[model samples]
Target: MTPISKKLSWVAAVGLLASGCAETPKELVDARAAYKRVSTGPAAKTNPVQVADAKRSLDQAEEACFSCWDTSAGRDKAYVALRKAEYADALSRNAMAGKDLEAGDVQLASLQKEYLSGVNARVAAENAAAAAALGTLGKTQAQLDADRAAAAAAQARAQAALDKIRGKLTQDERGTVITLPGALLFPTGKGNLTAGGKRNLDPLMEFLRTDPRKILIEGFTDSTGKAAFNQKLSQDRADTVMNDMIKYGNIPADKISAQGMGSQNPIGDNKTAEGRQLNRRVEIILLKPTN
Candidate 1:
């Protein structure tokens, strides 16, 4: 061979070797990039164990690429390494988010504790101020004891008076209530008081005259009638009872008021006759003294 042709053949061989050495599969390149990204990111700190696993997978892929005879084997290993790196990164981010959530919960708990403490402090301060004001008003411990005794005596007297009255007597937040049956007081669908009703109310009037307590007369009816009719009838009956107490029972008009409850606040099952009878009633509430 000629000298020039020999030199050209040697140069061509060198070029081919360089080209083969420089060429790398796309999967391997992608895997190397993914591993580097995860190792350098928060995954390095938050998920060190997973990041180490990802590094090992990348090393295996590099070994496969350099030593394995088959290109597909190298590619498959590279794909696995890429997936491991991505999983590590995802896990790291999730762990970081969980930590942030934990921190927020701690802060929220602290805020709630602070709020409760503030409320307790305010309430204690208010109580202290009220006690001081009471002291300034010349309310000694002896005076306070006397006031409590007086209040207890008043309650006992009211209870004793209520026990003497007939009808279903109940005590609630509104005061003492006496429920009188509508059947005994009036004929069905009528507003006028029956003879038995007048007799029943006579005791109530005498009690009121003696007790001198403020009163409210409320009328209720069963669900058998139309709502409008029931409402009007209840109002008329309440008014009639109030007028009778003022005229005959000698109760002060200024101390008594009347209202119609209609079919509201049923005392029993409306479907049964006994329940309906129980529902139709008049309620006289003896209000607590303003003192």
Candidate 2:
């Protein structure tokens, strides 16, 4: 070793050592500070995935500025910037999930306001639907009232027509008239039909046949006799009249149905002498077929 060469080598070694000893950061301290800031916040434990994303962003930021770690302050600032980026990443992750950002105490505060507005709009729609239903009900009630009025008018007309004929209906009397006068219909209380009863019913039967209206021969007896006695007598008289009309009057059987009303539906008052006479007669009411 020459003296000059040794001195140069020694100087070079001192320069290198001085450069290494310079006050500069080896690792980013600011990044750790920013990470601490985020970790200490409210969602630190509740949202571990968000915290993890924040840490990853900070690490990435630190990695991006590896060439500029000459001073401790510069390294700290770089790490701080990294933590800022991490916080932004965590916020973005929370936004993708379907949570009210503000109410959820997460990233996006504006989204919570939007959710409340939508809920209010739905309430307003329901109110509108209820109003529409009420309107329909009112219209239906009005139509029903009109229909009721029409039905009342129709019932009134039918009642008026029924009241006019036959004066108030009364109890009946059957064989009383049949056994009186010129040859009793079969001489006595016998069931055999007589020519005379046939003769009387023929004109009416023929008229009914021509008009195509149904005829009914209902017989009745005065209340003076036993109920069983009158029932048989009345039924016999009705049957006799019915057969005569069918055989000689050319009346359709379908258009006639004979019944013994016994002592029912008297045309005149049964208390009066004339009332008994009127009630002994046969009655036929026609019923027209409906189309």
Candidate 3:
């Protein structure tokens, strides 16, 4: 061997031995312990990606130990690897927590949307029901109004027909009244119906038979006669008229009544013939219908 080459080889071997004798830094020991804990512990199964990253860092640190030969540079590498390994584990846990929180938020949003839809559907149903009820009420009210109008029109026709047939009518609190002179129904001082009276009453009797209205026959006499005689005569006259109406008109007996108001509510003075004639009268009162 050449003298220069041999001397260079001997000097390099001595320098390598001196470097090997240097003490390893405490940071390297701690770095190795940290790497072992992460790779072989629970983190290896649960956090495989993080554990792999930690193993790479540990490999780099061990390579630095051989390259730098226990110098501070080697310890620095181990320290960096330990920090990186811890960060990987913590980052993986935080990511799992974030994913769980995101899923929870999505589920809560879906539930809220479903609840709002139910509320809206319920409100719509209630509104529809209320509208249908209101429509029914309106229809009922319209029917009632139509019925009332028809009834009023019928009553007006009845009044017009009665006035045309029975002469002018006067309405009072009691009922509608038709007044007739005593000469039209009976002879002077007589309770019997005259032939002309019977003929005149034929149309009225037919009306009574058709319509079946309630009736009240009232008789009055002039004050010229004795009070007792006039009362009896008036009563007999009213009874005769009622009996004739029931027989000729085929009127129900239960629908008619008779009364005598002799010398009471006189229409005129008893001293004059005209006034006395006016005072002697028979009245027919028509009662209101039940329905």
Best candidate, lDDT:
1
Model 3, range 130-160, lDDT digits (tens) per residue? 9999999999999999877765664465555
Give the better candidate number (2 or 3) by lDDT: 3
Clashing pairs in 3: none
- TM-score to native of every candidate shown: 0.45, 0.35, 0.51
lDDT of 2 at 133: 80
Instruction: Rank the models by TM-score, top first.
Output: 3, 1, 2
Superpose all Cα atoms of candidate 2 onto the true structure and report the RMSD in Å to 1 decimal: 13.3
Q: Ten residues in a row with the worst lDDT in model 1?
A: 157-166
Total clashing pairs in model 1: 0
Evaluate residue 152 in candidate 3 and report its C-alpha lDDT on the 0 to 100 scale: 64
Worst 10 residues of 3 by lDDT: 159-168
Off by over 4 Å in 2: 1-193
Q: For each candidate, what is the lDDT?
A: 0.84, 0.58, 0.77
- List per-candidate RMSD values in Å: 20.8, 13.3, 9.2
Model 2 lDDT per residue over 170-247, tens place? 223321111121123443445565676444444344344554545566676666577787778778777877777788
Clashing pairs in 2: 31-79, 170-265, 170-266, 171-266, 172-263, 172-264, 173-220, 173-221, 174-220, 174-221
lDDT for position 96 in model 2: 46
The list of candidate 3 runs beyond 4 A from truth reads 1-166, 206-213, 288-291
